[model samples]
Target chain A: MLTLAQAQTIMTTALAHAQSAGFKPLTIAILDARGAQKLFTAQDGTSLKRGEIAIGKAHGAVAMGIGSRALHKMALERPYFVEAATHAVGGSLVPVPGGVLIRDAAGTLLGAIGVSGDTSDNDEAAALAGITAAGLVGDTGA
Target chain B: MLTLAQAQTIMTTALAHAQSAGFKPLTIAILDARGAQKLFTAQDGTSLKRGEIAIGKAHGAVAMGIGSRALHKMALERPYFVEAATHAVGGSLVPVPGGVLIRDAAGTLLGAIGVSGDTSDNDEAAALAGITAAGLVGDTGA
Candidate 1:
């Protein structure tokens, strides 16, 4: 089981990366297998909107069982499904930046991480660092 | 400016109280003034279903500038406005347990918290813990 400590480490590392990269402050979230929040953080200067975007990305990854990039592509191909999910989930299905699937070395689905700060690419990179630092594998979908 | 630390601490204390009270596992969310995420947590056994409820409550509190309990009452008295907000926010309006406004000592708007667990009352109690822990005032709608 992924402990809250591990999730916090990922969030901390991700935020550190964002700071080192000179990106805007960010918000990060990690969710466990059952879509429960394990850890979440928002940096000092991060816009309030970034927090929701981060959660949406993380929530989207956990709900769809895939990295947000894949979900994003899926949304492009099947806008209707995305729309339906949006209505069904009631605003938790955000298919945007800073979300990725987290897995163990043996390929078990553990959870997900999301980050929001600079551009989507930068945010993705920061999230990937956190996953790697925590010794977790992330499905980047690219 | 509500720091993330304050938000997380509030949520942590709230969850602890909920667990001590033997309530069901929960999904809880907090949002700052700009409607961005401040903190989010899902207890060990909380189902994904709770996520929607929690988010809806938080969103409703922010959108209506009132506690969700008040919104629930208003919904009964003015169904049209509630229904319209439900549609306007892309289906994120929830006027039930687990939502409340966060205010400063002077009653300035700071943020909102939403929770989903046991009953609306239980959820409200948890939200109250979070708000109080953060040194923010809250109206439980009771």
Candidate 2:
């Protein structure tokens, strides 16, 4: 189980990575394995919709049991996949680059994290860094 | 009508109840009648998944007009019901005991609350206590 403390630490580290990279203010959302929300916060100056976007990404990752990066790739190759997932997950499946899953040392899926604010690549980089900082593995969705 | 203050109070009191019982850390989420998020937070040591479970429970309760405990019981009696709900609701329904409906003295539904992290029974107890503390009615979904 990825405790809230770990989730917060991951989020904080993710934010720091974004700041270090000179990215814009970001919104972060994390969910447990059961798709429960463990943590969420939006940096000041970010658009209101960033939170929803973050949630969409995180939920998409959780529901599909894959990273958003993978979903993004599939969506790019097959647009219908996005539509189907959106319909299936209540429009929360955002095929983006920032949503990734957290895995423990034994390769257990602990939860997911989504980041928004910067470009998709930047957001993803920040999120991956955050997961690594939390001593968990972050898949690239490949 | 549900205010953010009231939502926060309910979540806070819910956590207090869990703490009083020496239960595990928890996450709490509340939404208004329209299913808009009112407030959410996780205890320090709780898992990240608790928040999402709480949300699913709360959303499930609101969408079904019954407590999650009721859904849980129904799910036990009818397994296919869970699949149908997941499809109809876009996968947010969680047939768990932690989701409960909040009503006013006049029996008007103000919103719903979802709690997670501890055992389902403990989560339900904490959520009900919080509702009572907020001077609202907490339906047990029976």
Candidate 3:
């Protein structure tokens, strides 16, 4: 039951982290536990494609119940899974490092956040900061 | 142009209208001009089905460049067209009521809004109220 306000707080903080780090403009997507989109924003100047890619990353994280960083690693070690998963979601799945799950103090899965428009690692870093700033945990699979 | 604040305002007001009208819990979806989802929220007690249906309605309205009311009428008059269009979008299209386009004063397409819960007429009424409340034009097609 992550409220929309909470999602916005998390996403805004994520964008701020990107800003502070001098990262390029980023797009952020948030999805609730049901895999329903809660919020999405592509900051000014981001590429036209960033919104969908960011959303795909977040949707993938939620669908797999794991952070996208882990998926990226798995994709590297077992590329076949990536191909199959991508097709399974009708091309909405993205195996990347920018998607992360948000959890409560009790380790309940609330939702996920995905950031795009920078290096995958950097995008993950921003998402991590945002998740923490909103008083939640981000499972980066680290 | 449609700012996130404006989108939020519209969605919140739509929910309020539903609340006032004593309608069932509703879900709302807002999309930017490029058909990128900007915001989506399901009220506390809405059915799980509302989430996807709400999104589908909004996506369809944007793809067709008109309000869902018009699409609904078209579906009644030309069922085959709706079938082909739905299949075309990989089944994301919902040619039903409750989706409307937002436009600026100069008639520029800003985005679209979708609401689900209660009857289709009620949903469209709430969406239109929200559009008007936010000072945007809704292409309800009458």
Candidate 4:
């Protein structure tokens, strides 16, 4: 189980990296292995629905047990399957690079984190940085 | 009925109020009179589901044509009716104090704002303050 402290560390590090890189205002969501939201943040200037997108990215990663980067590829090669999965998950799946699954050193699934606001690649980099800063491995499914 | 600028004003003011009052991290949602989302923000470290709760509060207010405080009383006094209404609104109704209806000086409904993070009363207070700061009237259905 990912503790709140760990979740906070991930969020803090992610935001710090985004700020240092001068990315756009970001929204981040962290979900535990059970797919429940653990922590969320939306920067002051984020546009509407960024929060939902962040959550969807994280939620979909957890629901499908794969990083969203993998889901994005699946979405390309198997569009129908991805669409069905999106519906099955109540339309919360956003196949993109920003969502990454989190695992501990022993390869135990911890949770997932989703970031939005910057380019998808930049968002994914931020997620990876956060997970690494927390001493967890990030599975981008790449 | 509300512009994005107005929505941002409400959000900024609401967050300012929450901070000055030393309330917990908050999540806020602003919805137009047509029930479309206008803006949303979740402070860093907000708990899971707060975003939904905030949206539900505002969405329910806009859908029912009343503030969520009134909805709370309705939920208590006519539980079945409120339950049916909740279902009718696609299960977005959250009868609580933090949901408020926004109106112009001419008493035209412009939108609704929902807040979550602190006690219900404090949440409501923050909502009202935000609306007032935006130069709008807030109907809490009190």
Candidate 5:
């Protein structure tokens, strides 16, 4: 079962990765299975919008049970899915940087992590770090 | 002479402050004299809503020639101004957190910064950091 402690651990790890990478300040968010925020943190000098984006990305991942990057690929194959999903979510389901799926050792869905700032690759890396630090697995499939 | 470089610098600094303060992940944007984006960055994990909010705040600040916080206050006295400005900007002028005027050392208007995440106070502080880091001034009316 996913726990708040795990979420917090992921967020902390992501923040540290961002600082160490020498990227700009970052925003990290973790969402529970219900798509609610379990942990959210924005570094000093991070933009205000980072929080929203992080939440949106994580929400999308949790709601769909897939990593946002994979969703982006699916969007390309099924534009209708993308359109319908976006409309259904009231524009909160953004398939962009800073979204990752969290799973257990057995690949059971647990939650998700979203990160923003820097490049999309950098965001993915940070999210992965958070997941691993939390003793969870991250889905990076395309 | 105002330049995009200065605006970007301000935005970068503001984001850094936001992260250090433990605020939510955020999106930040800067607009030039013509109301064009000078710089835009969404920290790792920020949401799409933050982008909209940041842009709105920045637009409001530039259009009204006042900080967004002051605009929020003036909204009470001149609801019409707030309403009209909001409409004039195509519903992009949000009079809330993460927006401020950018002025030079001599108090000359250069541009504006908009931030979103956490609370309004935290947003404003981040924006102020950006302004000061850019060697510019911010009018928070505090």
Candidate 6:
């Protein structure tokens, strides 16, 4: 189970990384293994839809049981499959790099983190950094 | 515009109310007036869909520009209209009393709060108490 404190720690470290890296304002979402949101935050200047986008990334990762980087590749290789998958996930799937799965040292899935409001790579980097800070493995499907 | 600090304050106070009243575990959602989520939390042990339900309540109220208590009445009086309106809101409307609109003392709409996992009246009461603690007016359409 992902404790709320762990989720809060992940977000705090992620935002700190974003700040130090000089990324744009960000919106971040954390979801437990069941795909239920645990914590969410949108920076003051984030665009209106950024929060949904961030949640979509995290939700998609958890729903598909894969990191969103793989989903992005699938989207390119087979658009039709991604389209159907999107519907199956209730329209909350954003196939992109920023959605990463969190796993334990034993490869047990803990949850996911999604970040938005910067380049997809930068977003993913921030997420990975946060997961590392929490002493968890971040699987970006690389 | 609703500040994140205010949103945090609202959630903190609302949860305090729920705990004091011995309500069931809750999922709470807060949205800015533009219908974007600002903050969300699902207490431990909340059912799988409680978070979505909480978001639906707040999103529906903001979408319809009225508190969800009013939407519940509209649902009873004009079921078809309510049905259509639900579709218009992208299937996130929960026409129930737990969704309350937040407004300044001057009646300017700021945002909304939604709480789920207890009796609707109790949920609305907690939301109202939170808004009051934040020094904002909570319009439950009563």
**Best TM-score goes to which candidate?**
6
Q: Against the true structure, what is model 4's DockQ?
A: 0.13
Q: Which ten residues in a row have the lowest lDDT in candidate 2 chain A?
A: A41-50
Q: For each candidate, C-alpha RMSD in Å?
A: 4.4, 6.7, 2.6, 5.2, 15.6, 2.2
Candidate 6: CAPRI quality band: medium
- Docking quality (DockQ) of candidate 3: 0.34
Q: CA lDDT of A131 in candidate 5? A: 88
Which 10-residue span in candidate 3 chain B carries the lowest summed lDDT?
Answer: B39-48
Model 2 reaches an interface RMSD of 5.1
Error of 6 at A119 (Å): 1.6
- In the range B4-56, model 5's lDDT, one tens digit per residue, is 77877787787778778788888888887567888888888877587889888
- lDDT string, candidate 1, A17-129, tens digits: 88788988788888887776776777778764776688788888888777888778878999999879867776787776569888999999998887777788898999999
B1-142, model 1: which lDDT tens digit per residue? Answer: 6677778777888888898898887888887877777777666666657777887898788887888998888789999988998898779879875798888899788888888877998989988987788778886554
DockQ-derived CAPRI band for the predicted complex in model 2: incorrect
lDDT of 4 by residue, A44-112 (tens): 567768878988899999999999999999999999999999999899999999999999999999899
Report RMSD for candidate 2.
6.7
Q: Report the error of model 5 at residue B124, Å.
A: 24
TM-score, one value per model: 0.77, 0.59, 0.86, 0.68, 0.54, 0.90
2 against 6, candidate with superior lDDT: 6
> Across residues A37-120, which tens digit of lDDT does each residue of candidate 5 receive?
788887765533446556767777887777888766765577577656765765556566468888899988887888766776
Off by over 4 Å in 6: A76-84
Q: Which one wins on lDDT? A: 6
lDDT of 6 by residue, B1-142 (tens): 8887788889889999999999999889999989888888888888878899999899999998899999999999999998999998799999989999999899999999999999999999999998999999999977
In candidate 3, stretches whose alpha carbon ends up further than 4 angstroms from where it belongs are A1-5, A19-23, B20-22
Error of 1 at B36 (Å): 2.1
Regions of candidate 5 where Cα sits further than 4 Å from its true position: A77-80, B1-142
Regions of candidate 4 where Cα sits further than 4 Å from its true position: B1-67, B77-81, B97-141
- How well is each residue in A14-36 modelled by candidate 6, as lDDT tens digits? 99999999999999999999999
